[model samples]
Target: MDFHYHSLPDLFEQLGLPAEMPAVEHFIERHHPLPAAMLLADASFWSPSQASFLREEVLGDADWAEVVDDLNSRLHH
Candidate 1:
């Protein structure tokens, strides 16, 4: 399979969110510091579809995994 590099903005766009850097940063700032015990895919701010995409991509280690993981880290900080 061919591999494609996905950035944070790409992930956001795939999730149907605002994909601009400023919007992404604002989103992180608004929802950040996620509880240590909370799963990123279980975060309340995500729609069910968005959450499912995150969960599946990470679990499957798909093309979106790295960028999804990056987003997970940012949200927890």
Candidate 2:
């Protein structure tokens, strides 16, 4: 799917993580306000390649920047 528009679950699924609504909700509630880059770099569930692709490809690309920003906002207080 193009990263132009995505729901939180879609975004998480694309990132190779669990995208179940409750799981995502709990994760966010448990760890809201996560710094995008730091979380991506440090989260053990994500492989190095996955994190790099997300940080350098999705986040770095202008086309997907909006999606990344939205995720960041939801993550932060």
Candidate 3:
């Protein structure tokens, strides 16, 4: 089996968002500093489908989990 290493841009594409680095950076900048008590998947900016994808990937410890965790950290700071 081929293992594909995913990146933040890939995650954005998978979520049907802009995948360019600038767009990704802009997105993070727009949504920076998520509330400490808020879960990444529970943030108001995400669509239901996007939120579900994040929750499932993290809860299942799937391939997307690492990147999702990375996003979570970025959002928190």
Q: How far off is residue 50 in model 2, in Å?
A: 3.2
Residue 74 shift from truth in candidate 3, angstroms: 0.4
Better of 1 and 3 by TM-score: 1
* TM-score for candidate 3: 0.94
Model 3, 12-57: lDDT tens per residue?
A: 9999999999999999999989999999999999999999999998
lDDT of 2 by residue, 1-77 (tens): 45466677876787787899897788778767666565543556567876675677444675555665566566665
Q: Provide the TM-score for each candidate, comma-separated.
A: 0.96, 0.61, 0.94
Candidate 2: residue 18 Cα off by (Å)? 1.4
How far off is residue 69 in model 3, in Å? 0.4
lDDT of candidate 3 at residue 8, scale 0 to 100:
99
Question: Which ranking of candidates, highest TM-score first?
Answer: 1, 3, 2
Give per-residue lDDT, candidate 3, residue 56.
100
Q: Any residue pairs clashing in model 3, and if so which?
A: none
Instruction: Report each candidate's C-alpha RMSD, comma-separated, in the order given.
Output: 0.7, 3.6, 1.5
Q: Assess the local accuracy of residue 72 in candidate 1 as a C-alpha lDDT between 0 and 100.
A: 88
Of 1 and 3, the candidate ahead on lDDT is: 3
Residue 23 Cα positional deviation in candidate 3, in Å, after optimal superposition: 0.3
Of the two candidates 2 and 3, the one with more favorable TM-score, higher being better, is 3
